[model samples]
Target: MTKQITDDLAQALWETLLLHSTKGRLRYGDITAIACEFGLTTKAVTRVWKKGIRSMGDRVAAVVKAGWSRRGRKKSLQSQTRPRTTEDLIEESVMLEIMKCGGSNTYKIPHQHKDKLRNAGKLPTTLPCDVQA
Candidate 1:
C-alpha cells in the first residue's frame, strides 16, 4: 500500500512547488527531485500537486488557495432529520430484548419468530442455530 501523506507535509510540498513554478512551469525532473527528498514516488508528488494546485495550464499558482470543497455528506439540518420508522423502532426493541436475554441463542427465540422479525426488518440475516430454535 502507498504511504499516506500528512496534511502538513503535503501543504509544505505544495508551497515549495508553487515557489519553484512561479518562475516557469515545473518540470518532471523537479517533481522527481522533490519526490526523492520526501521519500515519495514522482507520481505521488504529481498527484498531490494536481489535487492541491488549481489550473495546471497556469505557469504560476498559489498552493494555499481556498475553494476546494470539504468532501463527504453535508450535515442534515435538525429539522430535516428523519424520525425512526415503526419497523426501525421494532427492530431496535427486539435487539435490546436479544441483548437482555442473550445474543441470538438464549430464551430460544424461535426460527419462525426470527423469520417474522426478518420480515419486519428486525433481523437482516439468518442466525447460526443448528435447529429452528
Candidate 2:
C-alpha cells in the first residue's frame, strides 16, 4: 500500500530532495541516504526524484492552492435533485393509497399516469411500478 504523507511531510521531503539533488537529479547513494533520514523506502524516494523538478514543485504548489474549494456539499444537477424511482415519480400523495388497492388505481390515475409522465418528458423506463396497468 502507498503511504499517505501529510502536506508538511511532503514539503519537507521535497525540500530535502532539492538540497541533495544536483541539476534536479539525485544519485543512488543520495536517494538511499535521504530515504533512511525520512524513514521512507528507497523506492519511494527514488520515484519522486525521477519525476524531476515539476513533481517537486507540485508538492509546494499544493499548499499554495489548498482550501480554495472550501469543502462543502456538492451542487446537485436539476434533473438529479429529486429521486427518479418509480414510486417517487408518482407525485400525488393520494396515488400511493390508490395504487396500494391493487396493481394500479381503479379509474383515472392508473390509466393516465404513464402517458402523463411520458408526454411530460420523463424516462419511459422509469414508469411507475404498476406494470399490469
Candidate 3:
C-alpha cells in the first residue's frame, strides 16, 4: 500500500529529484533509486518528476509570453529624451573672456595686462606669456 506524504515532504522530494536530474541526467531508474534513498516508493518519485516537469514548463511559457508582450509594446516618451550638450556654451564663454582681454595678440602689452591680471588673481599663473592677452 502507498503511504500518504505531507505537502512539505513532497516539495522537498520534488526539489531533490530536479537537482539530481540536472546534475546527473537522471532516468526513471535513477528516480527510483533516489526515492528508495528518501524512504519513498518509485511511484512517488514518478509523481514528483511529472510535477517538476510541468512546473518548469509553465514557468518557461510565462517568461516567453512576457518577452513577447514587451517586444510588441512601444517605448515610453521619457526614453526618447536627449540631454543637451554643454560644449557650445562652454566654448562661447571662453571666447567672450578672451575678447574681453582684447585681441589674442595683446600679450605684447608688456607686464600691464598679463602680470597685472596674474597678480590680481584674475588669470591663472600658468597662462603662457605668449597667450596671456
**Index of the highest-lDDT prediction:** 1
| TM-score rank order | 2, 1, 3
lDDT of 1 by residue, 20-82 (tens): 785547865899888888888888788777865555456455453322345567878999764
The lDDT of each candidate is 0.63, 0.60, 0.58
Q: Model 3 segments beyond 4 Å from truth?
A: 23-25, 60-133
**Number of colliding residue pairs in each model:** 0, 0, 0
* Candidate 3 per-residue C-alpha lDDT over 6-124 given as tens digits, one digit per residue, 9 for 90 to 100: 66677677667766775535854788678778787887767766766776767742111111234556776986754343344444445555665785744332233544554576754
What is candidate 2's lDDT per residue for 42-109, written digit by digit as tens?
Answer: 77766555544654567744231222255688887998665545554455434654666654556345
For TM-score, the strongest prediction is 2
Tell me the TM-score of each prediction against the true structure. 0.42, 0.44, 0.39
**RMSD in angstroms, candidate 1?**
10.4
Superposed on all Cα atoms, the candidates' RMSDs to the truth, in angstroms, are 10.4, 8.6, 17.9
Worst ten-residue run, lDDT, model 3? 61-70
